[model samples]
Target chain A: MKSSVRNQFEGTIKAIVRGEAVSEIDVETAAGIMSSIITTRSMEEMGLKVGDKVTAAVKATAVFVEKA
Target chain B: MKSSVRNQFEGTIKAIVRGEAVSEIDVETAAGIMSSIITTRSMEEMGLKVGDKVTAAVKATAVFVEKA
Candidate 1:
């Protein structure tokens, strides 16, 4: 899914779903767009907060980023 | 932009683009799919490494994840 449009946004962590040690960040961007839920086990490692500045860099490609 | 096909994959960080403090992770998933470039300044915060296992949770929505 390669799109010339590099979708990027910055917002606050409207919500956080704590799964095990990993956490899902729900950032609210401009308009009514709910950015994808980013999964990370270490929020402190990423210095992420409920109202911290962050950017989601989406690449234009089709690749599954999961575990076995 | 909601996609029932929640595209998720697991791979290694083939490349890393250092922009200031942020780093772009290029994870190589199954087939020839180059997963999106995830940007993060504190990789240790996310416990991400060059050969560390990671998952990209892509939400089917259109909300820019950038900075202002």
Candidate 2:
């Protein structure tokens, strides 16, 4: 009864939004939900940006439970 | 010549290995690789097991290609 989001996020890469197949990762967390919008195809072979200190290892069933 | 394995696997969960933090997932495929080993954190939540056909989406960055 307690799970909003928090599988893993070691943070930094601020933003990146390029899509053909899928790529829209924005991990910049510190406390909780600083920001996390992930959907990736490795982001052009890990050429990520903004700060680059990654660790976004999500797997909580691919995390999709939208209602809001 | 191009790549060893494809990026996605829309197949059945062939096996599972539970760990303290990460869970090892093995998905069965048709060709190119009958079984592909993956790591996920969604096993408990998803309650995945053998024969459960599910898509395994892995960010290519997390795939650490080790040398043997």
Error of 1 at B59 (Å): 3.1
lDDT of 2 by residue, A1-68 (tens): 22212466577867777667666666777854344343344455556677877766454546678796
Model 2 residue-pair collision total? 0
Q: What local lDDT does model 2 show for residue A64?
A: 78
Per-residue lDDT over A1-68 for candidate 1, one digit per residue giving the tens place of the 0 to 100 score: 44464434444667666566545666654423234444454455566667766654455433234443
**Chain B TM-score for candidate 2:** 0.57
Leading candidate by TM-score: 2
Give me the runs in candidate 2 sitting further than 4 Å from their true place: A1-68, B1-6, B32-41, B62-68
True contacts kept of 2: 0.00
What is the lDDT of every predicted structure here? 0.50, 0.56
CAPRI band for model 2: incorrect
* Fnat of all models, as shown: 0.30, 0.00
Query: Which candidate number has the best lDDT?
Result: 2
